[model samples]
Target: MRFLPFTLFLFSSYSLVKAGTLNKGDSCNIGDNRLQAGTYQFWSECNSQTYCGSSGKCETRGCRKDDFPFGYAPDDKLPEKCPKGQFCPDEEDQCQQIQPVGSDCQLNRDDQCEGPPNFKELADTSGRGLNVNGSVCLNSKCMWANATLGVACIVENTPYTAYGVDGEFIDIVSRGNCQLGLYCDAAQKVCMAEKLFGEACTADKECSSWNCLGSGVCGVSESIPHHFAIWVYIVVGLGIFGGMFGTLFGLYWTHRKQRDEEREKRMQYWREQNAFHQNLLAMRETARASILSLPGNGNSSARSTLYSRDGAFSDDVSAPILPNAAPKVSGLRHYLADDGSSEFDDGLMMQSGKKVDGRF
Candidate 1:
């Protein structure tokens, strides 16, 4: 249980780190150089000063710039904040106050005042009213639109704010409100058919859900939910533990089987030893009986007399005979021939019961 918390913590940290990294299909900001998916890490080919964005697209714009005046490194300093009450506009990079709706304005230069195409005087009814194409300058507000999809429009009853041409809401909170199979067209300011991720785009508004990266291709964000990461960690841990347990169990079974075989072998050896001992005892008893049946008492001479002079058991032959009438030869052979036998024969008889003399 103590190890459980540690294990969970380790896996949880891994999951959080993994979730923070981008997957192959996940979206990314323009400045990020590293994208991670599963166990793989992908490095963006973006230039040194540029980075991938949250829109999953690379961007040269909005890149951090060196604040040499503040003695900061290149691309390290943050953007300056605007003064209170005045909002900073992205196009001008400056702070300004809101202007009256239907006011005359230059595109991108006076975003704080909000106006479209600098065509405030060009209207359908009165110059103060809506434009000929249903565009309005109610509050001098204008918005970016994807040219491929929807055009910019204003709500009839509300203040003049940016909306899709199809009448769906389009704002920071209600982004693109496009219908099924449609995408918000920032260029055309309308909802249009969706494009694939890698399609060429002039701006982030053209991609289906991904942003047009600095490399000119659509990309996704890298962030993921914590629950998903936790689940992945649990699964991986379980798999590893299961594998280890299975290996241990397999080894135990193999050892047990070997022990059983060795036990059986030992039992068989003991059985063989008992049988040999029994046979040896029976042989010993038979020899004792045979000795008891002998004619003389249990003496060494009686045992020796059981065999004749030639080592054959014969009770009829008493002793060897010597013939004195035989001629003796000279030397050692002379003495040996007097015994009625040659030296090679000694005094033994063949199995056919014939006397043998030394001859060719």
Candidate 2:
């Protein structure tokens, strides 16, 4: 499946030129079977030209600089060394065709093929090697992005580095302005981080890998997982908050209602109390007039009669006491109207606090 894409790329390059167009026996000077026209088709994709003659075959691509051998552009030429052990540096000192950009690519620490490339892949891939915090704090686990040394990412480790600090692991490959809480983009050849911890970036100060998009966030594409659980958390938090508010509101309402009821009860009691005092005072006035008119006796004929009112002068002990005490009058005397033309005799007995007529 991977070969299919390569084949397509080659086929497109060779467009007008067919695969294996040259025959083996046709080239007596160079063994033709060793190099077929199909190979010529593969070299043409970058719009590079194929010139084959004797042992010399030059494949040219577009816009290459005067120094390079081959590339996406011409002028960046690369020698047509048909096979392995070929040095093809098309402008990019680290770039080569042996392991094309996408193919079994490898970036070493040194400049040469075996000497220790300046940069290396993240893993010990291509059977090359893994730099475990080499030239840095090796207590923690870490890897290099590429031999270019333009980017690096610090992988946090539980166990402290040999240095004994709780800090981050030192990157094996460090080139860009990376500090704490930052990552480097070896592919794009740029320094990056999620909201840069230390380094400065023109685009995204917080970008971890690529550009810090217009949203202004750095590193991860999403702050929250954008999952059902995220929404659930938000909803649950809101519900809890709302419940608290409602509880407080309900309590306040209940408290207010209770207070209002209590106040009303107090007011009602006061009104009744005030009425009681007023009634007593009026009764005292009436008693005073009655005493003044009395004939020295604490009795009157009308006072003996039973009134229709519910508490009409009853002698019940629980009944309210009169506001004023009646004056005592003697039964040993007769009484006459104001003119002294008539005389009368009568008596009264204080029974159960009410005057009883006496005819003895």
Candidate 3:
């Protein structure tokens, strides 16, 4: 049972170490492989009040504000303000007496110079912990911020480093030694106002518009408008609607015209057919009347007997004669005596004789 407690303690310690909550002098792995310039390389991370040193061990941190601000440090290790008459150095891990104006200092390392006494108080009250006091390290020397428009200034072309709470560098950037809203001119070597539109510019910072066109001129922002004018929308809508309507109407008109033409052709054809039928009926009637008006035979009774009640020839009648009929003389009859017989009667007798011969 006593060994059980010891085992539990060892397990707990092992779990704590595995959790990565390291302490001073504990071995750790560095965060990344690429080490930045002008910054310290630390192993993993250490607990509050300590930082990983070059020897790969945790060492006590010197100044809090210079290395780790309130939010940059661990939650429980919020940094405090630097002591009076002392300032933090960028390269060292200790606080030193503040440097007076005109003293030798490193560029972009403003922490080494003296600033407004109330800067800390203002930062705490304003909720923005920025070192924006008049003092700044410019051109490798401590100086008060005085780079106004038309004033001589130095343009630092080299990049400067910024450190994280663990004294590890995080960012590197180049900002010329000029006051706010001013930029150092590379050619004139003086601070100048930001350029207006259409002015020649080489960089975005040189223009108040923050836009440097490819033609090397300060120009308007290049943002494309996503919304069109109401009139444009209306015009486009009308155009589409008109196009559809015109297409439909054109098709309808064409179809209607075709149908009308077809109907007209059909009607005209029907009229022609009707007229032809009517003319044919009239011709038939005239033909019937002409046939009825012809001279009748002298033997009316005989002619009447040849036709039936329906005005057609009777089946019993073999031959019928007209009223204007004349006897035809045969040439052979000149050689013989005149028979005194009508041609019609002779033709009937001959036909009757032929019938009798056929039967025999």
Candidate 4:
């Protein structure tokens, strides 16, 4: 009794490992094969009769020729005898059914025999049953139940699932039934995990975060924070203000320098004008002193001297002539006064045998 539980545990573990590897719609033969890819059904042929069970693997189908004694229940009230090769088995005494396929039962109607046997009653020809949980009657034949997630399935004659079946790869997922964190890969008819940031993507729906960049990739949104924007504006404003201040300062300094240079030029011109005026005044004073120290008086005889060049005066000894007087010439002596005008003097001289005489 204790070994029973251990045996069941080993069987279930083996079943899980087997099911995890096989997907739906795999092609398999009855001999030397386990359950179908997706379902737990089995099939095999026995004595030219193939029998299929929900969980048993077999090669052939239909009833065996040796067990032909069974028959369908009789609908008539008459006591009919068993046919030549068939017998009135006690298990079904209601009526004697038809013989095996090749036997001559001489019965013309299908009502003479019972319907085909149930698939579950068949033996496992492959000895590969997994004791699947959900086996049910489908179309009067037993097979595994409908498929679910992670289960292999045949869709439109094609194999698909979490893993593949029948040597086909599962590539795409259909819409409307994908679990959370998974999206339908429609091209391959399979579900795939959602895309993260920077992963290759064609649309925002394929990503988990709902953002897609322009470069055909998934990513975060391109938006700046409010504080960062404010900082940027402040930096630009400060740059503009500094540039304006620098320009104004440069202009002001250049204007001050130009004004100072002009002032110095004007001062030098005034000094030169003042020195020329002083030199002119000193020259006028020196000229006035020299004029004051002259020997002649303003109205003396030197100024009133007149010349008598007549021959009668030249011979007269009574003529008053100043001694040491120069010989007479026809020109006048000039003197300058303080008013800067000229004064002229005219004198006459007579010579009688070396006795010089002058009358002014």
Candidate 5:
């Protein structure tokens, strides 16, 4: 980010239009009267300058051509340029040029970090900047380490601890359900210690040894505490579904609907479709009979039937079709057609072993 000086930087300049001698011959445009030019102050406030700037100031692009005896800006240095954004401090002077600086840094989303130079170790004697180690110093200053980003540094202290502690990194304390001396997810900040209501326990699994008391250090799950939301979610879900099933049939009946009519209509449509299917099956069976030999009455031959299905027909519909090999009466037979007719030996028909001829 662009750093402002926090204050204005002022400077003095020697350039201002003085009422010195206008030192040349002057004349009146009308009539032949010649006027001698000695020194002239601004004849009026309207007598602005020897130059007319682009902004019409008394500088830069000088006077009009009509004002000059010969032409405008006769001298090569008749004008002075200003900084792009700024104008002159006064009409007689040149403008100062200044470079632009942005107000903020470009965002760097590397999940990495950035910063100004830091002080690694402050001097005890002299109150100056820093004394860094080999791993420090970028442009003569230290850099702070980001533990989260795994940024390393040749520091004099352990990470994640108060600067100058014991030889150990950090003293152990269970943040949640993790042990201090054991492994814990540092990101989660939880430890595997027994967070008991009364006293600190040796371990989480020692609840039974502590007599499973309400006040002693014990495992969270001798009867573990649940997240408030887990119980809320379960209860809310149960209530919603239970209320759906256990309706008094009042609000549910008045506002909610049975959908039984739609159900029945779908079922009737299915039945009509099934009947149409059965007719198709009978036709298929008749076609099969034309090409294939028929099973005899006494000399029975076991046969299998393939059931009819509407959609992707993946049903393993193979089943024995016959009444007697001792009349095993294998099952309701299927003819390869989209009908509800069960294929049987006599023809495709059966209702609890009673014959009723209809299209499937």
Candidate 6:
């Protein structure tokens, strides 16, 4: 018996989940006060082909695109276009009859107004059959095309509001209520001709040139001349190329200068090393010459006696004494001459070639 209650709850949840959207003539409620002015609400239970009417029931919508341009209704079920004598009102599910000239109307609802019956027949033969009738909603009233060029006109500055399918604010767009090929000048409050290039303008639509620059002047069209655009591209390309070339040239020059400076330093170092080596070679050559000029074949007894007596070469001795040359000196002639004693004796002995003590 307790499980019966649980089963009933499950069945109720399944039925709610399986329920489909409300069709025409089905009861629906959006849970809000929709009768209040400026209040809009969508009944989510109603299907796309119908809307919850004031009677609190889903009803067939008269128009789709004009009422719900943001896809609030089904495309296949709704009429493709509004009927000729009627127009769709914003946020309304029914099409209302077009109002006559001078009738009261809402701002920005120009479609609800009707044009002159003989407007097409009165046009010129070339413009006949064309849809050029200027019937617009101005100053909250339906009016015919009466404002001519340079004449006073009503310009609706209020932006048109667009709402989402759920009645959420989506966007707002500003539109002027003016005749064909003309726009209402907001500053002058008059119908004025579209401005040409270089003319002053406050909005883009006021210019025939198709563009209004930020300086409030009518500028040229967006499409630039092919030749002028090509020249601009060429100039930009040349600038980029010149910049890159200059950068690469500067880098190369700096690298070359660094390499040259390094080479010069290396050359200076090698030159100094060469000079040092040459000085060493010259000193070695002078030392070899002094050793080769020394007299050889001296008696060992006399050389030993001389060194033992002097202990070292005398300062007055001018002959260069080479290292390890003592054993090569055979006589005391060179040493005795430099000592300033027995020069004649040494000369006579060298000339006679005779031994004084049987060993010379």
Q: Give the C-alpha miss distance for residue 115 in model 1, angstroms.
A: 26
Top candidate by lDDT: 6
Using all chains and alpha carbons, the TM-scores for the candidates as numbered come to 0.26, 0.23, 0.37, 0.26, 0.14, 0.41
| Higher-ranked by lDDT: 1 or 5 | 1
What overall lDDT goes with each candidate model? 0.41, 0.36, 0.53, 0.38, 0.31, 0.55
Residue 232 in model 2: lDDT: 92
Model 5 off-target regions past 4 Å? 1-59, 63-283, 290-293, 297-328, 335-338, 341-348, 353-360
Q: Note the residue pairs that clash in candidate 3.
A: 297-323, 298-323
Q: In model 6, how large is the Cα lDDT of residue 9?
A: 27
Query: How many steric clashes between backbone atoms does each model show?
Result: 40, 38, 2, 23, 20, 3
Error of 6 at 274 (Å): 54
Preferred candidate (TM-score higher): 2 or 4: 4
Global Cα RMSD, each model: 21.7, 24.2, 22.7, 33.4, 31.5, 19.4
For residues 304-334, what per-residue lDDT tens digits would candidate 3 score against the true structure? 5554444455576666565655332234333
Order the candidates by lDDT, highest first.
6, 3, 1, 4, 2, 5
Candidate 6: misplaced stretches above 4 Å?
Answer: 1-48, 66-76, 117-132, 160-178, 221-360
**For model 6, what is the alpha-carbon lDDT of residue 24?**
86
Estimate, for each residue in 1-360, the C-alpha lDDT of model 1 and write its tens digit: 000001112232233332233333445554544433321222353433233455564443332222222213566645555554354332222446645445543322222443335333332232211232223222235332212235443221111122236863322211232333444443454666756677766444345543556777665622223355788989999999999999999999999999999999999999999999899767755754564454432333332344455555647455433353222122433333454533233321223344434321
**TM-score leaderboard ranking:** 6, 3, 1, 4, 2, 5
The number of residue pairs in model 3 that clash at the backbone is: 2
The TM-score measured for candidate 1 stands at 0.26
Off by over 4 Å in 2: 1-226, 229-234, 237-241, 295-360
Candidate 3: residue 259 lDDT (0-100): 100
lDDT of 1: 0.41
- The TM-score of candidate 5 is 0.14
